[model samples]
Target: MKIYSYPSHVKQDIKEFIEKRLDSGTFGLLVQGDEDTIEDVKDLMFDQDDVTGNGSGSYTFNTLKAEECLVGNWDLLREAKEELQPNVDLIEKGPEFCDVMIRCYLLDWCFNKALAEIVNNTETVQKGDN
Candidate 1:
């Protein structure tokens, strides 16, 4: 598996967050946002609104907005997570932690999508040369 690295601060914050969750037995914590936020995430992942359909009504998905959303959300969550302290109430810090987890998952999706695109394009170009 490829090793993913974060900035020192983000890496430290994630380590502490995981330790706190384990210590508090909060492993079941759910990360969720409002419906509008959910829709925004979908749009960021798929560019849902920009999709087009062929004459036979089969839709083509072209854009991937994951990298853009991931970068922005990661920065925001990093700032919020950095403000957390060991003494801070878990209730107060839960939302920020959830945001960080959610963004991390999104970043994983973005990285996978980018990799798939690179592979697919390379295959297409190779086939064209035949």
Candidate 2:
């Protein structure tokens, strides 16, 4: 999916898709970025600890943080993809850091899908309040 720096009408499609799943009128989106990027994001939030909040705000933050982190290390993903080609399909789907960074990031996406659903549920709940 393409990342955006600003919230434009372009996101209307995803917003609508998310709206369809809002149970309580709230929608949430979860995205994964590189560990270094996540670390930087986590660092930026050093004092912000509340996980329960607006989905729109959180999604924007995640996308931005991931974009920064991924861009900073795009080469690592490419290298790993090249090096692991011999036996990539054999690796167990777990937290095992490999030569490539994006592999874990990609795996993080698999795990984050569930989180996105929960966030979507939250988003739906929030929408009902609007």
Model 1 bad stretches (over 4 Å)? 1-91, 94-97
Candidate 2, residue 121: Cα displacement in angstroms equals 1.0
Per-residue lDDT over 4-49 for candidate 2, one digit per residue giving the tens place of the 0 to 100 score: 2121221332334334533332221123334554344333222221
In order, what is each prediction's RMSD in angstroms?
19.3, 15.2
What does candidate 1's lDDT look like per residue over 6-118, in tens digits? 33323343333333433322322212223453344334433211221112222222112222223445454454345533354535534433333433434434433433444
- Model 1 Cα RMSD, Å? 19.3
Residue 36 in model 2: lDDT: 56
| Ten-residue stretch with the least lDDT total in model 1 | 47-56
Candidate achieving the largest TM-score: 1
Which ten-residue region of model 2 has the weakest summed lDDT? 47-56
Would you list the C-alpha lDDT of every candidate in the order shown? 0.36, 0.36
